[model samples]
Target: MRAADRFSFNHATAKFWDQREAVEACARAGVGIGLWREPVQEMGLEASAKLVQDAGVAVTSLCRGGFFTDPTPAAIDDNRRAIDEAAALGAPALVLVSGGIPAGGTIDGAREGVQEALSVLAPYAGERGVTLAIEPLHPMFASDRCVVTTIGEALDLAAPFPAEQVGVVVDTYHIWWDPQVWQGIARAGREGRIASFQFADWVTPLPAGVLTGRGQLGDGCIDFKRYLAEVDAAGFTGPIEVELFNDALWARPGAEVLAETKAAFERVVS
Candidate 1:
């Protein structure tokens, strides 16, 4: 199939976009969508689910559901709720961002928290038919955003669970710089653990905070074709969600941003 056929516009790319409009826009373009929980909740889960279902837009994967670095019962409960949401929306995967080091805690201790949390949540996700897709952020985000900084580490955390219950997200913006990324992707595929695939570009001279600095496709240095080729070769023939977190893009009109993103995706990966 063509790359466009697998394109999914992650809502966060246009952070301020109206959720209903975004879903309709994606539907008009015949593309899938990756939804975020806040907006989904705002729209009311049932309403949000009905919107996409009525629009005939596939809900590729839910944006996030993990922050289990501390693994409190509350954290586990929240993840279970997220799993229920994903299942309610007919989303196959719930992307997870292993939270940063907790205060007064070491990174090692935090990782153990993630493992513990997953052991409980993974089974719950499996029961709901949702895959817990662990996402490894760039090492730069290890302290505040995501502690899991490499595909390898994410895989290790997912090792103890069934691939159907727990998997990893292969997002280019985060893993492109890993020298061992190719091997990591291969291993994820071999183990049937590639549950979600995302695309974003890495630009130089990052923004002050770097949290909202992801570049649009082809705007920076990421080699879209290489990532596409590798993931495809690795056997992940699924939706390729472009999930840019750029401030500039977010400031524009949602429809305009979506169009630009779709065009850029085709230009770079097709």
Candidate 2:
């Protein structure tokens, strides 16, 4: 298939994009999409499901269902709801942004908490035919964002579960800084756990929150072809989701961003 055939626009890339508008754009372009929980819920569970179904857009994966480090029963319950939402949207994978360090907790402790969360939620997801995709954020966000910061760490977290039930998301912006990214991709492929592949460029002078500073494709130094070759060598053939969380992108119209994002993806991956 062509590189564009695998292109999926993650709605979070354009943070304020309307859910209906995003879905329609992806469908019109014959592209797949990754959705977030809030907007999906805002549209009402069944309504959102019908919207995607009617739009004929494929839901590549759900944006989140983690943060189990909170040690609250509500966390697992929310994940269960997320899994249900994914099922309703016919999404095969539910992305988990395993949250940051807990209060009075060490990194190791937080990791253990993630493992515990999975042990409870994995089987539930499995029963629902949804794979739990653990997305490792950049290490810079380790303290306040995701505790899982590398593909290797994500794979380690996925080790105890069946690959069919748990897998890792490989996004360039998050792992491009890691020296062992290729090794991790190989390992994920060997283990049959390469669940989701995404792209975003890393730029310096990160903004205050460090959340919305992602650079446009060609604006930053990420080596996209290298990542593509490595993952392909590792045997992953799946949707390539482009997720750019940037203030500039979010400020523009969603349709314009989608068009620009698709062009950037073609420039880099085609």
The candidate that achieves the highest TM-score relative to the unseen native structure: 1
lDDT (tens digit, per residue) of candidate 2 on 159-265: 99999899999989899999988899999999999889999998776777578888888788899988998998888878899999888889999999999999999
- Please write out the lDDT profile of model 1 over residues 141-194, one tens digit for every residue: 898779999999999999999999999999999999999999999999999999
lDDT values, one for every candidate: 0.93, 0.91
RMSD of each: 0.7, 1.1
What value of lDDT does candidate 1 attain over all alpha carbons? 0.93
Q: List the residue pairs that clash in candidate 1.
A: none
Clash number by candidate, in order: 0, 0
Off by over 4 Å in 2: none
